[model samples]
Target: MLESLTPFETVLVAGASRGVGREIARILQPNFTVKALLRSNIAVNELEVLGIQPIMGDAMIPEQLDLSGIDAVISTIGGLPGDIKRADDEGNRNLIDAARKAGVKKFVLVTSIGCGDSVVALPPRALEALGAVLEDKEKAEQHLIDSGLTYTIVRPGGLKSEPATGTGFLTEDPKISGSIHRADVADLVCKCLISDRANQKILSALDRNQMFSASEIVEFIP
Candidate 1:
């Protein structure tokens, strides 16, 4: 059973220009006052058209991130291969620090499956390919854990761009791994944003029918 939680009225989403972050921002826009942190003005128009306010700032720059009056934050920032300044660790650190400074209510971080203790869930080849990025993501996850804020760290498996399947769910099992749609990940993130059961927990998000193994699926319903 999940405890009742106060809903967050304002949300700031990092990495909302594309992928799961974009979907999360889109989902939250209708219900909450949604804001997106962008490194540049490229996606400002697009996000504004979706009823999301685009705040011009880079997550990698600490001073640029302003979380004042924001009740919650959702971060899906990542970096490219061989990039000197990866947003996976550094950018998330800045956001976490800012959230702490502003006294935000909750912080939800969307990382990959290979992060932290879930590394055993991925194949060796896949691990080799994502090792560096996963390491940075794990660091970010740890930062959030130690930040002393209400937080939920969601590590999704291989991400698909398809529409939400309505079967995406969350579990505390670190060993779970599978493919889940980006939209479904967004839905799960939104649920966790106000879920008392998800606070201070690290969860794996996946579709019920997309598991890579035949393990028992005990989902944490928010």
Candidate 2:
């Protein structure tokens, strides 16, 4: 059994302006002092309205990392559509290095399901579609795994904007696939910040009843 521990006092959220990162910050605000890393003034203003403390810095640049006094870091970093590929990886690696330097205890990284060994969990067509980004995410994951920090790597499926259906489950099962609501992913990421069950684990997040089982993809993917 994983040991229970005290909640972190300060948590830095990378990519907290949008998607799962944004929601994670919102969810974490009640329990922890939430600091979100952002790039633009507009993003800063937008996040500040929601009571999230915003730090202005692009994760793609290492020099901009002014982070300090952080006990844990939750990174939901990813490339935006039409942006350059692997940008998120570069940013995440920079954050990982910063966390290591700061001696942050827990680092939760949010990557997609088609990354690394999770590729087997996706259909061949989907895998092909995700080729470049997955490779970059793979590098980031390996770095975090070898970083010697207490870490949780969450690989959530196709993100949806709908409300949480509350069917989400975390499994080490690489055979699991399918989509999860972004809110559900945020909820899980927040829980992982304090859950001992998440330490050093690579978890796939999915709706229990919506899984893309291995049997369905075996003939096409394997």
Candidate 3:
């Protein structure tokens, strides 16, 4: 279990219309003032129903993202198969720039396991299939690292939509590879948001029982 510290009162979440970003906004809604940056009006009603304020904007357009009043920021934005502009790098780059200009306290970016030093953990076939996307995510990761903001980069392994297994955890070991539920990734991201120890860290998230190898694991507790 992770200990909670002085939590940020207001948070802005990018990519909150769906996936892990949506889950993170859901988790933070009850305790904090949560805002989601959205490119469309489609999810506005749905997010408003959950007590999350939806800001109509696109992360890819720097002028559209205004983070002035946000205390913290979390981005799980990515690209689609036929997208003309990938959000994995360009979108995140704009967000990082906005966060820096807004002086946001912390930024939590959700990427994939094959990003950065974790590439060795993936099978060659998987790497071949996802090489382009991983390269883009790595670019986003590096952008955040170089942005001079307190940041936590979480590279989750293969993602599942099932309920959290509770066994999901994080490790600094980039060689670790496994599958984890999206809810579990949301949980870890929330924990890292308030954890000073997670600042400036790049960690991999996985389920203990779903690892691809039997290597010894040292879980990172924050």
Candidates' RMSD to native:
2.3, 4.7, 1.5
Reference-based TM-score of each model: 0.95, 0.90, 0.96
Best by TM-score: 3
Q: lDDT of each model, Cα atoms only?
A: 0.91, 0.81, 0.92
lDDT of 3 at 69: 91
For model 3, the local distance difference test gives: 0.92
Which of candidates 1 and 3 reaches a greater lDDT? 3
Number of backbone collisions per candidate: 0, 0, 0
**Shift of residue 125 alpha carbon in model 3, Å:** 0.9
Instruction: Using TM-score, rank the candidates from best to worst.
Output: 3, 1, 2
The better candidate by TM-score, 1 or 3, is 3
lDDT of 1 by residue, 8-36 (tens): 88899999999999999988887788999
As a whole number from 0 to 100, the lDDT of residue 77 in candidate 2 is 84
Give per-residue lDDT, candidate 2, residue 13.
94
* Ranking of predictions according to lDDT: 3, 1, 2
